[model samples]
Target: MVHQLAGRLNSIDPQAGEALRIVSYFDVLIARGVGLDGLLRGAALLSGTVAGAEIRGRVTRRDPDGHAPADAADARRRSSPRSHDTWTVWLERDGEPGPDDDMIAERLALGVYLLEERRRPDSGIDAIIDPNRSAAERAVFLARHRTDPETRVRVLATPADAADTGAPSAIVPTRYGLLKATLDRSGRLAPPEPAGLGTWVRADRAPESWDAAIIALRLTAPDTPTVDATDLGAMLLLAQAHDPQAPHEDVRALAALDQRSSDVLRTLVEADSIRSAAGTLGMHHSTVQARHEALTATLGYDPRTTTGRMRYTAAALLLRLIDPITPARTPSA
Candidate 1:
């Protein structure tokens, strides 16, 4: 089984070697009958952030001021989670999904993979700065200082291969009909096709190889709940590209409108809220519609599509709004 998995890793693309670590984690886990869901629940306990992957806590320590090293297992051991010893969380084994030696090896491999991927530049997208912007200030390092003033910034990225490639592998393989759904949720492995596989497929007709990457930014529409540093960087770039003066946001106050009239505008954007903004705000359906009307009069963009949202959020954050070059208001996200 180890040999088979090794061969699979060898077959992965060179640009994707960094991500196979995550694959190895799952490979070992599935070989032992432990599924990713178990890993997910286990991960939630240690890391405050829960992701649908084999658990190895995120470690963000990349600032001028030294910070503590972050690790999933270490975090789990240290955190005061509710389910430290529920005992109900048993490992499957012997034809059933068990968290045995094989599972341990796989999960560990996954951890290593994610760790290395975070270090990769491609996956390490800068959320604060837009790729379209000019000057060093348009980079994540500089832009973060402007976005969130009170933040203690710590940036995390998906594994390099994981973020750039196709759909992740779906463990607990079911019938063929359900394979795509399973892949979509795993968020680990990658496939080349998008039809029945996932959304990470390559496109030949694109203007550049990055066409798929650009499309992904548009389609991902990541909810605030599932926000990742890499995705955040992508959004910032998209926002800057949409409007140099606007910031990307779910909803922002329209300076031009009165509070009462603005409330109605918020309702419009709320009704057709983009990605995860609606869920984050715990807002009503009409909220997006309400916001849209106001944005149209102010930020100069639509909130319904990716370009629009990018413009809106940037305007909201004032990505490049340029307000007297306020001395780096927010710390970071």
Candidate 2:
């Protein structure tokens, strides 16, 4: 298996030789049923060829001062998420590890392979990251990192511009999939396609972080060329509220209006002023005013009012959930 992987890695680029060897060592330990914690320890030792080499995963919360929050793992078994997003890997030797452009590409590709394997046993990397090891092994692994400050959890998401790639195995046929990568606490990322970022956390919280990462990926715009979890913002909140099966009453009401009324109402809501809406819709000011009053009567609220505006906006958001591809404002009605 090592020889086969070496050949494939060499084909991708000769530089991958070192990484492939590391992965191969990991593979051996995995086949021996050495748990993830053991694999990480082994990786740290293997990377010792580099000066002061260390390998560890961290769930980092960055502060405005360009620092990470103090280690609070002793009092916590989970992440106290604040601006909570992205998981990162630290591969350091003599200097602070960082992901430059080239390193980002490498990590992104590796992450994609690892993520696929996690879902199903597609390659050797799968065995390395899986958490379901024997109780003894898991205990041993936990013992090794019990004092570590970083949370040992991960979040994975795909970037917008993923590419077609083959599976990690040399003989497996290639297929298209999102490229994924792990980010660091410093917010550095490799270019991602099936892009994702992971962090260290209490073992139990890993799945929650992973779910958030998936939500971030779903909110990512298709036209967005790159992926970053930090940008999810309120979109994540909306994602939490989004219910595809729920009846969207306001959205339905908006859709039920006539084309001119719908267009006029949307314009009024967007522009905030009747005159501006009239200019935008190319209708007389009085005509727009009349439509606005008519819409208010139909919807039982004046759209210009704050309460009405909130409903309109929420309905618009709901409409997006319903038919995201459709324009925010329908044509005619």
Give the best candidate by TM-score: 2
Note the Cα lDDT for every prediction shown. 0.32, 0.44
Candidate 2: tens digits of C-alpha lDDT, residues 1-333: 345546766787776755555444443553454433443345334433111111134433222232333644223222111110123233332343422322322332233233334444333222123345443443443344342223454545443234323222111111112223222223343434434344344543443444455444443455753444446555446645766556367777875777777777878988958999999999899988888888888887889988999888767655544432110110010
What is the alpha-carbon lDDT of model 2 when measured against the actual structure?
A: 0.44
Estimate, for each residue in 203-283, the C-alpha lDDT of model 1 and write its tens digit: 111112122232232232224312222344454455335532242343334444576554544444445443344454566
Off by over 4 Å in 1: 1-108, 114-215, 221-333
User: Which whole-number lDDT from 0 to 100 does residue 16 have in model 1?
Assistant: 38
Q: Which stretches of candidate 2 lie over 4 Å from their true place?
A: 1-149, 152-156, 159-161, 164-186, 190-238, 254-263, 298-300, 324-333
Supply candidate 2's per-residue lDDT for 254. 78
**What value of lDDT does candidate 1 attain over all alpha carbons?**
0.32
- Model 2 TM: 0.40
